[model samples]
Target chain A: MQAGKPILYSYFRSSCSWRVRIALALKSIDYEMVTVNLIKDGGQQFSEEFQALNPMKQVPALKIDGITIGQSLAIIEYLEETRPTPRLLPQDPKKRAHVRMISDLIASGIQPLQNLSVLKQVGQEKQLSWAQQVISSGFNALERILQSTAGKYCVGDEVSMADLCLVPQVANADRYKVDLTPYPTISRINKSLLTLEAFQVSHPCRQPDTPPELRA
Target chain B: MQAGKPILYSYFRSSCSWRVRIALALKSIDYEMVTVNLIKDGGQQFSEEFQALNPMKQVPALKIDGITIGQSLAIIEYLEETRPTPRLLPQDPKKRAHVRMISDLIASGIQPLQNLSVLKQVGQEKQLSWAQQVISSGFNALERILQSTAGKYCVGDEVSMADLCLVPQVANADRYKVDLTPYPTISRINKSLLTLEAFQVSHPCRQPDTPPELRA
Candidate 1:
């Protein structure tokens, strides 16, 4: 491990960054936050300095164990490998696969399609409907999967990585005004996960860069 | 383990499916391939029968150990856990993080943005340019990352999960006519990875459903 507290490059409203925040809190790992404003100064993530840290030019990059890891799931996996307390992935291979499937369903399948960069290309006139359509389609599948997988949380009651992915994405859905009534399972799981300290403390509304008006 | 051979729900041309195919080949695992033509019959993946297996309605779902695993990365992770030999993920924590970072850089960052479904929404007129732009921009970042991390392979000489992701995305790049010259590091690594039998046999051109005109 590194000698000092690890640092996290983050954007308050980024669902990807929020996923990492929840993981860091869940593992009880204290870290410094360096906010990379995704909107201001024409997206600070594109800045040369930030680009050096993450060539992908995205936030939620963690400086830990003397190395910087980008990608929320990768950082969380590293944390799980090194920390192993209050495990975010189940032990049984089959159960772990389920957690990962749900996580990727959100992380890769849904989140990427509706993120800021894609939305920028989608244009202002179409962004709302585009995000709504994307989120609803993904939620349709997620709802069915969660029907069989949920037990107070996504993938049983463990509050695994899937929960980390779920809560932030649901936040995005809310931002885009996607009707959640049709996705009862997703809505129920998000509601239950919101009550946890990890999810509460790591929420976008509670982050350092969260605007005063948006802060909880 | 299950009494019978595992089954892979796949489409020949889906990069995501090709990813799982490469992993299965590397692990030397015996599995049955059930082709789900993504285009035929208004997209077979959307069929109720297929949705029952993978609520996400995506190819590359694996039925292994008596449970259905969706998402290529999730399936690959499961195979790595159970098979272990000729490991797809490195054992070192930091190295593993790098492998995952690269894998996701392509899988989530690059692939989903230009996928057939996304392109369908992008429309036939804009599909080519749209795919070119998405792939080129992603490759710009990936090329920079690979400049430092790569050595014969994406992360050192070993063929980790990152290589599995790189080769398939490079194939997609080829299909889209994205100039490979700008990304020498990625091109070189991909060129080396292509020589392996696992990559050749699992290639989109050689799959069971590969059209006669497109077959190598």
Candidate 2:
């Protein structure tokens, strides 16, 4: 096992990186954060050193167990395996699948569509509308799914990987100015989740790298 | 277990649906295909009946064990759990995590950005370039990751979940004309994967619902 404290190569504003940061805090894994400014120097994540850690050149690459793991969900899975305390996924097969379904809906279905890279590609004129449409479509599904699966959280009372992924994507949705009025369950869950210390401290604004003006 | 063949609610052209189709074939699980015709009836997936099966209103929702599972990867995971004979994920934790990393890079990183809904929203003009850029960026990392993780397949010779996720994504890349020459390993692996009968049968062109003219 890697002896040193785990290091997270991340940026404050990246929703993908935020998912990892929340997960690390949820699992209570102490790790050092090395910010990779996604905007500065045409993206610090493109640097050779960072690329070596994560060839994807994406942030939230965790250095642990003498190995570097990229992909926020993948890193969270590794952490879950190594540190099972306060589990991030449900034990039941169906519930676990349910949790993953919601997580994937956000991670793959929502987040990628409205990501900064995508927004930039769409340009300023259409970016907001484009992102809102994507997030709105996803939130519609999320609200319906939560009708049966949710109870104080995305999936029943306990926090699963779904919650970790949920809060960040919702945060992004807010940034994209997507109306949450149509998604009562999602808004309720987001409100409840943000009240917790784990979710509180991991918010993008509270991160060490968050810009002063953006800080809450 | 519920009797009869499992039902796959899918559309032939969906790359995400193709992933599950390949996985079901790989595991030798008999599943009946119910074509959803993503292009017709203003997209049948958005219909209330379809939404009941999958709140996300996405294709490749599987009906098995008396429960409908949405999300292609989540469906695959459920299938992996119910039928473990032909393992889709690696046995080792690290290797499994590695396999999942590549899967997410495609599933979450690339696929969603170029999804049909997103494409329609981006408008006809910029769609092709938008998709190509996203695929190109993802392929750059996939190529690098495969350098170490690949050996005859995406993870040391065995056809893990990574390959299943890869083949379909690469298919989308080809459709968008992403220019595969820059990524040798991805092309090589895609070539190897396509050679398998399971992959062949699960191909979009070979699906039951594929238009006759589009059939391979």
Per-residue lDDT for B73 in model 2?
A: 82
What 10-residue stretch in candidate 2 chain A is worst by lDDT?
Answer: A112-121
Q: Compose the digit string of candidate 1's lDDT tens values, residues B86-151.
A: 998888999999999998888889999999999999889989999999999999999998887888
CA lDDT, every model vs. true structure: 0.92, 0.87
- Each candidate: fraction of true contacts kept? 0.86, 0.79
Instruction: Looking at model 2 chain B, report the run of 10 residues with the lowest lDDT sum.
Output: B60-69
In order, the TM-score of chain B in each prediction is 0.98, 0.97
Report the C-alpha displacement of residue A12, candidate 2, in angstroms: 1.6
Please give, for residues A92-199, the per-residue lDDT of candidate 1 as tens digits.
Answer: 898899999999999999999999999998899999999999999999999999898889899888889999999999999999999999998999889988988999
Candidate 2, residues A71-152, lDDT tens digits: the string is 8888887888878989988888788888889989988888878877777878899888888888898898889889999988
Shift in Å, residue B177, candidate 1: 0.5
The 10 consecutive residues of candidate 1 chain B with the worst lDDT sum are B1-10
Any runs in candidate 2 off by more than 4 Å, and if so which?
B1-4
lDDT of 2 at A112: 77
* Per-candidate alpha-carbon RMSD to the true structure: 1.1, 1.6
A194: Cα error in model 1, Å: 0.8
TM-score of each: 0.98, 0.96
